[model samples]
Target: MRYEPISNELFIQNRKNFMAQMKPNSVAAFNSNDIYPIGADSTIPFQQDRNIYYLSGVDQEDSILVLFPDAPKPEHREILFLKETNPHIAVWEGEKIDEEKALQIAGIKTVYWLKDFHKIFHELMSQSETIYINTNEHYRAAHDTETREDRFNKWLKENYPAHQVAKSNPILQRLRSVKHQLELDTMQTACNITEKAFRRILKETKPNIWEFELEAEIMHEFLKNRSRGFAYTPIIASGKNATVLHYIENKHQCKDGDLILFDVGAEYANYASDMSRTIPVNGKFTDRQKQIYNAVNRVKKEATKMLVPGTLWAEYHVEVGKLMTSELLDLKLLDKADVQNEDPKWPAYKKYFMHGTSHHIGLDTHDYGLLHEPIKANQVFTVEPGIYLPEEHIGVRLEDDVVIQENGEPFNLMRNIPIEIEEIEDLMNQ
Candidate 1:
């Protein structure tokens, strides 16, 4: 891992919290993500499953975490199964986590190799009455590949037809939504790296620069600052490309008067920070551009203030829609008649600002908070508001990560990143 080690207590606390929600006499299991294949001999980079990483802090392939808080034997309560390392494998893959290192990283005293998993898991399952299975229940999930966890779930259900099954997603959705101070610090580091990249682009952007060139500059800054590149694919959309919400081609040349909408962030220690900023290619916003920019900025500020504790996620978005509607009216993109005649379901603002104002941001860019629940303190969210005018070839979006406090407004994690028109212009022209 390029990032530094995270304290084992975070994983320990996470496991404890997760176990508390499990049914008595239940054994829960989590698997590391597969190192996917690209071709016959090539493979995509490995990423640890967030569920397993949250519980064990074991960021390796062929690993599993098993927890049975009320087990017949104390040693089986919390166990980690790691892929055993040999001398030849060590020489090839730089030392995979040895038994001792696994204990140190996960703080679990009991460790077994992958070879012993089937036998041990069978014994554990026989002693347990229920099994808690992890599933991808995030709102944006659309996986077609069968994961290691998915395969295990199928095998377990087929073999143990009498065992009661429970869902781990609900508990994890709530638990992972609230950020610990340590987790917040890690995410803040990611945001700081993203700020450096944005500042670098501010100075480097100019007329006729290729969009992919800006992407390279940002990646360079992220790597130099110890971040593992972008949290998501960098969106260096300039000109008409900005109108496309998920534009990531990044192969177009930036024209002199066009606006570049940069939607990118860096990841530190697997925590994500999401940001979006639109600026003119020449380092100055035209009069119309400044007007629209200020309008979008105002909506973001007001919407951020409403993200404090106790706000219901669904209701909060409805309020944000109203704010966006007013801003669009001020920008002259939506007329009064358009709003009155608009469908109650989509609303007039959906024409321009369609996506969303905010989403939970953390380990995943669109992380694991349940949208139906009330907001909580220590929860981190992103406040992103935009106005995409395809006809005018203008799209202005401003986003920042924030932490909700027990009292008063949420704390802006990306506050140091330039957003004000004057501040951005000064930094770009410097």
Candidate 2:
């Protein structure tokens, strides 16, 4: 791992919180993600499963975290099973986490090799009456491939037919939604790194520079600051490309007056910070661009104020839609009658702003959280509002990661990052 070690207390508290919610004599299991295959004899980089990482702080593949809070033996309450690294795996894929290292990384002292898992798990299963299985149940999830967690769930159900099954996803969705102080600090570090990258680009970006070059600059800054590159695949969209949400083919050369949409962020210690800022290729935005940018920025600010506790995700977006609708009307993109005559299902603002105003941001960029539930204090969300105009070749989105507060405004993690038009202009010119 490129990032420094996180304090064990965070994982300890996470485990304690999770265990408190579990039924008596029930054990919850979390599995590391598979190092997926790419082509012949090649494999994609191993990304640890966020849930296991959340509870155990174990970042390696083929690892298992067993949380048996009510185990007969105290030592068996929390155990970690790592893929046994021998000379062969070491030679082929480099040294994986050993027992001593795993113990330090995770707070668990009971560690075993993967080879002993079936036997040991079977013995443990004999004592456990219930099994808590985790599945990817994120609101936006569209997973097709079976994961390691899925396989284990199948194995457990088939082997222990009489055992009562429970869903771990629900518990995690609620728990992980709210941020711990440590988690918030980690995300702050990520946002700080992203701020550095953005500042660097503000001073460096000029006409004729390739969009990919800006992407490279952001990645360079992230890595130098102990971040493991982008939290998600960056979208360095410039010119008309910005109109296409999720545009990642950063091959176009930024023209003189074109705006570059940088949807980039950094990850530190497995925590994610999501940010989006649109800046001119040169030092200043055109009058039209400035108008649209300020409009979107206004919408973002207005939308963010509603992220306080007790706000429902559905209702929050509807309120944000009204904010966006007003902005579009101000931009002359929508007439008063256009909004009045629009379908209730798809508002007039949908033409300009399509995606949701916000989503939970944490270990995963689009982190797990129940949208149906009211927003809670300490929950982190990204407030992004954009206006895309394919006809005018303009798209402006301003986003920041914020923590919901009990009273007053939510705390903006990217508060240090320049957002004000004048601040951005000064930074660009300086």
Q: Give per-model CA RMSD.
A: 0.9, 1.4
lDDT on C-alpha atoms for all candidate structures: 0.92, 0.91
User: Model 2: per-residue lDDT, tens digit, 172-224?
Assistant: 99999999998998999999999999999998899999999999998999999
Instruction: Name the best candidate (by lDDT).
Output: 1
List of clashing residue pairs for candidate 1: none
Model 1: which ten-residue window has the lowest total lDDT? 97-106
Determine which window of 10 residues in candidate 2 has minimal summed lDDT. Answer: 98-107
TM-score of every candidate relative to the true structure = 0.99, 0.97
Model 1 misplaced regions, further than 4 Å = none
| Steric overlap count per candidate | 0, 0
Candidate 1, residues 1-430, lDDT tens digits: the string is: 8888899889889999999989989999999998999999899988889999988889899998999999889999999988988899988898888768877888898999989999999999999999999899999999899999999899989998899999999999999999989899999999999999999999999999999999999999999989888999989999889989999999999998889999999988889999999999999999988988998999999999999888998899999999988988887889999999999899999999889888999899999999888899999999999988898889889999999999998999998999999988898888
- Report the Cα lDDT for residue 424, model 1: 87
Candidate 2 matches the true fold with a TM-score of 0.97
lDDT of 1 at 353: 89
